[model samples]
Target: MDEDLMRALREDRGVKATALAKALGLSRVGIYEAVKRGEIQATRIGRRIVIPAHVARRLLGIEMEAA
Candidate 1:
């Protein structure tokens, strides 16, 4: 993972699908595909879909802090 993306994930509470797709160099449809395949987890907040920071970190192989 790049430093900028790591920093963004670390600082943000959650990431939107578009931002996540950009970070991963994927299209929005790719993100949707991942969600369908259960490769990434997402939650819908009204019309917006949000991916938790911890989940993104895990997908990037970043160690998460113990809760």
Candidate 2:
């Protein structure tokens, strides 16, 4: 994967299920099912479930940003 793409993926803040599913070649339904099963951590705010950027990176085994 390109470094630029990785950076963009890491910084992404929108609903992650779609992007993550596409990147991992998995279905969006699978992603949501995983979240519902606690395979990944996500929080519900109002009507949207938001997966934090760092949490997404961690789940994908991507490196964290330097402190």
Candidate 3:
């Protein structure tokens, strides 16, 4: 993996589901549905759904800690 990607992954605290879906060219509803079906990793912050950075790291096979 690229060092810049690794660095960015480590620095990400949380990624909005909508933004993630948009970035991946997926539907927001599909993203939410995937979350509901446990196909994707996510967490709820009171009422907001957030895709945690750790999930992204794990998916990309880039385990890292923020400097």
Candidate 4:
């Protein structure tokens, strides 16, 4: 995983499941499974599902910024 890419995603509010899957080099189904397993947090906005940046950081074991 690219730290810079992850950081950029973290700086954003969230990312789409498909985009995140691409970023993590996993299939869309794999990302969905992670969401199902509670390894990542997701929110439904209209028809789109988004995963928050902080949650991704935590899952990837990246250091979080002070709140």
Instruction: Specify the highest-lDDT model's number.
Output: 1
Query: How do the predictions measure up, each by TM-score?
Result: 0.68, 0.64, 0.66, 0.63
**Candidate 2: TM-score?**
0.64
**Model 2 residue pairs with clashes:** none
Q: Rank candidates, TM-score, best first.
A: 1, 3, 2, 4
* Full-model lDDT, candidate 1: 0.76
Give the worst 10-residue stretch by lDDT in candidate 2.
1-10
Residue range 1-67, candidate 4, lDDT tens digits: 6555566665766767887787668898999888888877898789787888766666556675664
* Better-scoring candidate (lDDT), 1 or 4: 1
What are the runs in model 4 whose C-alpha is more than 4 Å off? 1-10, 60-67
**Candidate 1, superposed: residue stretches over 4 Å from native:** 1-8, 61-67
Query: lDDT score, residue 25, model 1?
Result: 83
Better of 2 and 3 by lDDT: 3
Q: Could you tell me which 10 consecutive residues in candidate 1 have the lowest summed lDDT?
A: 58-67
lDDT score, candidate 2, position 42? 80
Tens-place lDDT digits, model 3, residues 1-67: 4444445466777767776666567898988998999988999998888888777656555567546
Q: lDDT for every model? A: 0.76, 0.68, 0.72, 0.74
Order the numbered candidates by lDDT, best leading: 1, 4, 3, 2
Clashes of each: 0, 0, 0, 0
Q: Cα lDDT for residue 48, model 3? A: 82
Residue lDDT tens for model 1, 22-56: 77789989998888788889988897877888887
Residue pairs in collision within model 1? none
Clashes of 4: 0
lDDT of 2 by residue, 1-67 (tens): 4454466555665445666666667897888888899987887788666666766677667785664
